[model samples]
Target: MKISFLLHNAYGIGGTITTTFNLAQALATVGHTVEIVSVLRHRERPNFQLDPRVGLRPLVDLRQEKEHPQHLRPAKVFPAAEYRYRQYSELTDERIGACLADIDADVVVGTRPGLNVHLALQAPERVARVGQEHLTLDNHPSRLRTALRRAYRRLDVLTTVTEADAAAYRRKMRLPGVRVEALPNSVPDPALPPADGNAKLVVAAGRLVPVKRYDLLIEAFARVVAERPDWRLRIYGKGEEHDRLRALTESLGLSENVFLMGAAAPMEAEWVKGSIGAAASNFEPFGMTIVEAMRCGLPVVSTDCPYGPGEIIEDGVDGRLVPVGDAAAFGAALLELVQDDERRHRMGRSALDNARRFAPGPVVAQAERLMEEAIEARRAGRPVSQDRAPMRQILVGRGYAARDAVHATGSSALRTVRKGRR
Candidate 1:
């Protein structure tokens, strides 16, 4: 079967891009033809290495399309809401519609919400369309949420990284024809050995964006630094918040102890040098960095955020979880792990054991099953097994609110009907 992946930007080093690339490669390895369709090609070069078997195609050359000369700066001030809306409309008109009309694939999957909306509304009727939501539905703007609730009616399946996120989509959107499935991100197994000699380094890695809450990590690290003068904290990733975070570090007298290492390539090697991993995000849909750190056998200290960390980290077993946004608690948690070598080692071993659950093979197998179910439902002109009454009851029993359970069940029913027809 031929499959096409639609992504916002494939050239950058991000969790979504990496996961899409890995999944595409996994499908290709199973003798399926896979192609990546990037909406915007901003750079002449790609930062993340992609599988050679996967074909790359870019819809827009952003650099060439710009009108300003080298020294001249483009207008930076614009209404955020209006600008986003305009960009979404333009994507549908200029790229998405054209791509759908040209490509003849068995299935097409959209990797983000904007692209998901496009795939559901613009893709040809003959092809099976799937929408993958990388972030929780709660993070979406009001307008986009309404659009997705309506647009998802056209999609065959809706996938998210965690059960909590899926439940949020079901509750908030109240949409039909959506089958929310858990498809967590996977990483390549680490080649480096676990940290043997630790200089008491704690690492956090992700885009230095507001949602990541790097500021909170810095505040927490300051407390750790005051107690253990020899320990250091290293944060990797580049974004608009660099200067602000640096300023905060200086203000906190953490200029020397906290290092803003911008976007480290081969992040696994960096993870191997750390004794502990930290994820201080306010809300993380799924913390891929947590798993990456665990794969390198580093015990993690993460916030008990909305969806991911709570599900991934078995508190006090594999790692520790502090209350979200509590610098004191986070500092205390980090200090506890940092000071105890035996406890850290025990948790690191457990973390490595837990990492096996997210291996590519198992994740790919789950994806394949969803695809096959979609195809079979389309062929038979009947609802898929996912829409059965028992499943609906189970979702309700699992603590999903009443209204959400109804919406999810209805969506599953619709998906079965639409897919069964094909």
Candidate 2:
């Protein structure tokens, strides 16, 4: 089977990029033809190592194509309410549409909401259009949610990283013929041996963004430091919140106890360096870092966030979960593991064993099944009922499709007009 993934950017480092590359490589390893169609490319190569067997095709090269005719114009096909709206434009819409219209693959998966809208509205009827939601529905703006509800009806299958998000979609959105499923992100088993749960370090990694709640983690760690100053916390990742977090650490006199270790790709080494993993996010679509740490035999202590932490970590078993934004509870949870060596080691063993479910073998199997089912459904010519959405929503969705069609048709004329004016 030939599978193609449509990604916003493959050159960058992100959870979506990591998971997509992991799954694509896994598919290639199993003798299937897999390719990644990156919508934009800013760097010479991707930050993460990509398998040589898997092909990469970048549509718009940002390094050289900054002055394209329609590069500055806002995107019409991609929804304006989408978070990455400012990054997309008419040029991207055209490039992505042209690729999908002629793409040769049994399955084409979109990695983000904006790109998913493109795939759902533009991909050929014969191809299986699969959209992967890495973020929960509740996280999206109401306007964006409305847009997705209309556009997603045309999708063959919509997969969320967490089952809770899938349930939300099934209950909130009415996509009659679409198969909504939960497909956890794949994390390849580390090449190094798992951690032995002896280190005094506690590790947390992710973008140093506000939503990650690194401040909360630091506050929680302060409580731990007061009792056991020997234990240290290392946070890896670079983002806008670096200075603020550093200031907070200094203010609390935790400069020595908490260290802001900047971004480290291939965090397996870092995960093994710590005896415990930690996250204090207000929300997580799926806990990729939690699974990564668990794979390295570090039981994570994370906030029991809306969708992911509860699903990934079994409280008092493989890992511990505390209430969101509660530094006291989070600190106590960390202390529970820190104070007990035997229990920590046992939980680490359990974490390593249980995290295997997120390994490539099982995740790729689920992906293959989803793609196969979608293909079979398409081949059988199952009709998608229009009653899936209200008449108003259906018309709005059709308007989106029709507008894009018009944009494609008039591209040459608009370019000619601009050149004449110049």
Best-performing candidate as measured by TM-score: 2
Pairs in steric clash, model 1: 177-411, 237-263, 377-419, 377-420, 378-419, 378-422, 381-420, 382-420, 383-416
What C-alpha lDDT, on a 0 to 100 scale, does residue 19 get in candidate 1? Answer: 86
lDDT of 1 by residue, 1-422 (tens): 78899987787778888889879988888788999998767898678877889989987667774332421332121112222343333433455678988788878999887677778877876677878988888877786676677778778888898877877777777666556776777777577777653658998999999989999999998888888979999999999899999999999999889999999876998999988999999999899999899888888999999888976777787789999999999999998988888999899997886676565655565676677777666556554455523433644565544543433332234335545776
Error in Å for residue 144 of model 1:
1.6
TM-score for predicted model 1 compared with the true structure: 0.85
Give the 10-residue window scoring lowest on summed lDDT in candidate 2: 403-412
Instruction: Residues 1-422, candidate 2: write the lDDT tens digits.
Output: 89999998999978999999999999999889999999999999899999999999899899998778788888999999999998889999999999999999998999999999999999999998889999989899999999999999889989998767888999998888898877888899699999999999999999999999999999999999998999999999999999999999999999989999998989999999999999999988898999999999999999999788877787887899999999999999999999999999999998897677677766676677678778877777873322222222332343433332222222123335445776
| Candidate 2 residue runs with Cα over 4 Å from true position | 383-422
RMSD of 2: 13.8
lDDT of each: 0.77, 0.87
* Residue 344 in model 1: lDDT: 90
What is the lDDT, from 0 to 100, of the residue 356 in candidate 2? 74
* lDDT score, candidate 2, position 408: 22
